[model samples]
Target chain A: MEILETALMQRALIAAVLVGVIAPAVGIYLVQRRQALMGDGIGHVAMTGVGLGFLLSASPVWMATLVAIVGSIAMELIRAYGRTRGDIALAMLFYGGMAGGVLLINLSPTGSNANLSSYLFGSLSTVSEGDLDAIWVLAALVVLVTVGLRRQLFAVSQDEEFARVTGLPVRALNLLVAVTAAVTVTVAMRVVGLLLVSALMVVPVAAAQQITRSFAVTFVLSVVIGTAVTLAGTVTSYYQDVPPGATIVLLAIGVFLVLTVLATPLARRRARALRPERDEHPAAEADGPAVPAMRGPADEARV
Target chain B: MTTTQTESAGQDTNGAKDATTPTVLSLRGATATLGSRPVLRGIDVSLRRGEVVALLGANGSGKSTAVRSVIGQVPLTSGEVTLFGTPLRRFRDWARVGYVPQRTTAASGVPATVREVVSSGRLARTGLLRWPSKADRAAVQRAIDLVGLTDRAKDAVGALSGGQHQRVLIARALAAEPELLIMDEPMAGVDLASQEILAATLRDQVAAGTTVLLVLHELGPLEPLIDRAVVLRDGCVMHDGPPPKAVGQHALPGHDPELLTNQSCHPHAAGEPHRTGLLT
Candidate 1:
């Protein structure tokens, strides 16, 4: 309670909660599209932006957001147009961004490995007032896009070709996803760190899906799981002097493992409930003999 | 003289048969290449209202490519496609069209219930950004029921069998209530039960005057609903009328005894086994 009274602790908790919500909200779509590692790429690109911020003596959070957006859009373009050479293009972007950050930070007058390490792995105590304001604005934007356009985003992520045929502006929506994911990376940068932001984005969704049957349930449950783990990890770190980012990610992975173990029994129970219907018609279960009775009505219906 | 000239040009493009029933889709000299290999070489296909046309071919015969070109999925290198009399490039009325691309499973990267996937079909009709109305919900439910997956509507699609997964895909397309349904290989690996349900569903759509263009490996159960069969042999129309005599006989009157007696043997009614059984 005393720690919560401090301005620094309050700032850290607010940032943690926002990261918990926004990361998995955007991450669900990425996981849906099977591009879970896309967050990791954006995180890498944001490092260059952070380094540029140090060199210019500007806010690292906003700078990382700008560069990550450009990098993510480039990744989306390469994915859309350069099918054969996409992986190679992404590899170059990821490594180039990482190398650029190290080079730029060292060249800066005031920057050092210690300063970079805080951004790389996250420093809750270092969340300045300006960073908080930026995070709040950015997080609001992420929430608006992810929640407001859920149906459209769901359609696009589920099947791009079908979404195009539905006249859903699949290309624009895809770019929007890339851009939103980049924004989320910067939003989580201060609390979860640039290097580990992706775990918060992906792990919670993956864990929730272990027992869920539908996307909506998976989404709501993941957000709940994310917020819980983040708050718990932050509090635990406050007490134990552990890194909040590492603690939060470890908690998420722990949740995933527990859910996975629980899912098997849950699934078996579901199968057992469905067994009676199969038992009622044993012939249908057997792939061999075509039930002549079923075919007769089908023909009559056609006539 | 200019008015008559334009009218004659329209007639020339649409052909004489299109006068009675308006063309739902038409492709003229639709040439498409996949990575330098000519997949569609001067292919042409036309479907009129209420027509249930099947595009049939052996593997690599460009049947899939021709349909893909019709839907504007694959760009034509040098040709034109018209959907419901409007050129594909200008045709924005996508709500009138429902597409079911060939896929063995309806399961995506994420676990989605049968209802969730089917609801996406109604998006074309509901438009983007609008919440689904009560009517939209009913339509989605009806589509799931049409494919006989009402019970499984709430269940994850990943848990479904292959045939049931195919049914979910068909159900998704049906939710749009599109005037024109374009399905590529709707019956590739479906089981007998799903095949019957799909056939019945297609039959109902045809009776309601929904124009259909499907790419199929074999007619199988849908043999009865097909009004015309366009056989493609290496990117060219080899035959396009009356469901081809050799294939039609197996499905129509002459093969009832063999079909009934060897029902187990002919699991896929008019499949390869039936053809081989005929020769034996």
Candidate 2:
């Protein structure tokens, strides 16, 4: 209660909540597309944006957003036309971005390495009023775009070729996702830091997936899980005197591991119950008349 | 000479509908190259309304590429593609077209349920920023029932077998109730029982007057529903006529003898080299 009374702690908590909500909304698409690591890649690129901002004496948050958007679009373009496999291109961006950021930080005469470290691991005092404003604006944009194009994004993520064939603007939608992801990484960096931002993006979604079957449910559950973890972690870190970024990420990972462990046996039980009926009427289960008279024993099973 | 022959041949099989029904899909001199290799060379194909046309060929024979070209997945270097009488570049009425891509062994890793995946097929019809209407939901339910996966509507698609997954994809396509349905290898890995179910599903679609363009290896259960078959070899159209009569009863015009013998053994052969020449 005392920790929540401080203005600095209040700002950090608000930033955390905003990041928690939007990160997983974007992360769900990345996870579905099997590009979960893209979050990490964009986070690293945002560091370069921050370094560039310091060099030019501009707002680091806005600079990081601009750079991350360009970087995300670059990643998409490179993945589309790059001679090598997609992962290789992503790796190139990830390491290239970090190295560039480090070089820029060292070259800037006004800022020290300590400033970079705050972004790497996050500091409760680093989220200024301007940074919070930027985060809110960007978070709202990401949420709006994602919700507006949810179906198209889901279709493309499910099957790219099929989506294209059905006349969905696959390329433009992909660019939109990439741009949103870039913004998410940049905004999240203020709360979770560049290095740990991806944990906020991916871990909550992973945990949500273990319990939810439909995309919409998974999306909503991810946001709830992310928000709870961020709030709890930030408040606990304020009292315990630990880095809030590390606390938040660790909490997300802990939740994921627990859900994964619990889901295994539950899945096995459902499979076991369905196996007998599946064996007896494989044809009827697969392609028999619509709406079979009898249902599987595990019909009531929930994920 | 081949052009004249194919045109006349196509007319022979498409006689009834060819005259009155306008062409829903037409690929003229369509040529596409994939990574320096020409996949579809001067390919020409036309599908009329309410007709079910199958694109058949061996592996790497451009059967898949041809269909991909029609859908604008594969860019044509030199050719034209017209959909519903409009050039492909200007055509935007996507709700009228449904596509089911070839199945991939790699899982999408997204745990979407059968109903959820089927509902996505109605996305084009639902449009942007809008929830599914009562009609959209009804169409999705109808599609699931048609595929006989009503019981698994709430189940995750990952739990389904290969054959069942194929059926789910078919149901997704059917949910749109498109005027033109294009499927690439719908029966490649499907079991015989599921294939029969798909055949029945196609029979209903054909009766309901849905124009279909399918890429297949051989005509198994769907043989009866096919009004015409277009055979591809390498990157060119080889034969365009009625579905080859029951494998061995009569040889297709340009088919090789050895390929015909192998077809008897592998009745549902999909893109296999030996079955390519057994078009008849």
Candidate 3:
């Protein structure tokens, strides 16, 4: 009861909810672009910032977000280099950032007593009102960028090549993606910690995608799931006397597993509900187009 | 969009029954090298207003690259691409140049409706800070109607079939209300009926004063739609005329006559664009 009454727990809960807003909002692009690993990379890099802050005795969120932005840019730049796949590049940064953080911390070693386990694993009892205020500010920035550029982001996410041809500033859009990832990972670092932050962004959005083809639905459902998980996990962790971030991530995983099991039937029912629009199996047949070769060179002139 | 040559072309097209003015799209001495490999060489071709020009090239013939270069996606190694009567660099947004990229699958996979896809075409003209105007909305509706996708306006593009998706892209290009519409391989992977639908839509756009430029493989499917053919080989123009005459043993000028040999040793070796797909 005292824990519930404590000022710190209330602040942490507030912070978690505030940060939760970012996951589903930004996750719309991150999940679809299959850049779930980008969040993972950003999280690892955020850890380095946390370690650096501990060594220098500065604020962790500030330092973590700075490293996170750099790491996000690095991830994008490396992924664009040659045939290096995005996942491979992310993993490189993920491990490299972790190593770099450890090295930086060891070198400075200002606070040998600072327990990194809580930072890596997360601590709901640690958030201050000031921390929550800062999280809200970051969350608001994310909301603005997402709303202002949602259309372009949607168009780009759907087809980056087509987006480029249509004169979208694809390079700028790519940079925005990295920026959003950095922001989300940094804020989320407090709620879900470094290890499971990507899951908070990706899982709910992916679950939302499976339920509907509408971009709006995917987005809305992700927010609902994110909010729900953040709330439920915080309450449950408070009552159960466990680590908040780990419990919340595990709860999210459970939700994902259940959603996956329920998806096919729900999808079929929804499709069947609109039977006239979806003619039997026609929609299914039309789903995936094979990589078709060009038709024979024709005599057709450019019209 | 401020090019000095467009009014002349417009007046010329309006003069007769579907009379085309002079060429607005012209590429000369074009060369492309990707990853240290030559893809195009010394290309020279021009597309006239009211002309539905089919870019025919065997696979690896650099047809897509040629089209991409025309719209400024691919930079020329040593060539000039003129739009409306001036150089491409002079234009700001190239608002008059609408493009449907070669990545059709990517275009169609976006979780949007046909109408939304068409609305994206207006985005270039809309720029960043502004939403689509009523005029833009009407144009989108018109483009969707033109593509005969009004029935499926609300359906997810991902739910569309091969041919329907192509129509969606074409409708998107049309929404820009551009004079020059560049679509890459609009006919690939589509069913016969869908191809027929696309061909009909292309004809409509052309009739409505839009110059259609596309990369095409099978001439037979698009025979009814194309107005002329331009062949590219090794980044150079091989033939420029009607499709039937475009195919022949004649090679591009300024290159060795033997550059037309069917050897992979010189993939970009100048020759006719009809060297078949780069299946080799």
Best by TM-score: 2
Q: Which stretches of candidate 3 lie over 4 Å from their true place?
A: A1-5, A81-90, A112-114, A273-278, A281-303, B1-23, B103-110, B245-280
Instruction: Please compute DockQ, using alpha carbons, for every candidate against the native two-chain complex.
Output: 0.56, 0.55, 0.34
Sorting all predicted structures by lDDT, with the top scorer first, yields 1, 2, 3
RMSD of each: 8.8, 8.2, 6.6
Off by over 4 Å in 1: A277-303, B1-18, B248-280
Ranking 2 against 3 by DockQ, winner? 2
TM-score for all models, in order of appearance = 0.88, 0.89, 0.84
Model 2 over residues B1-280: C-alpha lDDT tens digits? 1364544655676657856778999999888888977677677788889889988877787888888888887889998999999999999888899888899888775679999888889887876567888999999999999999998898888878888999999999988899999999999889988998888988898899999999988877788888888877667766677777765212443355433322222324334244344592
CAPRI grade of model 2:
medium
Local error of candidate 3 at B39, Å?
1.1
Model 1 chain B lowest lDDT segment of ten: B258-267
- Which residue pairs in candidate 1 collide? none
How would you order the candidates by DockQ, starting with the best?
Answer: 1, 2, 3
Error of 2 at A30 (Å): 0.4
lDDT of 3 by residue, A1-303 (tens): 675687877887787887677887887787667566678878888888988888788887899999899888887777655373766767777898898777777677574425566667777778777788888889988988887888788777776666776677877888888888898888888788888888888877776666666676677787888888988888888788778888877877777788888888886776676647555565656986556577777664445
lDDT of 2: 0.83
How far residue A136's Cα lies from its native spot in candidate 2, in Å, is: 1.9
lDDT by residue (A154-174, candidate 1, tens digit) is 999998888888878889999
> Which model is ahead, 1 or 3, in terms of DockQ?
1
lDDT of 3 at A12: 77
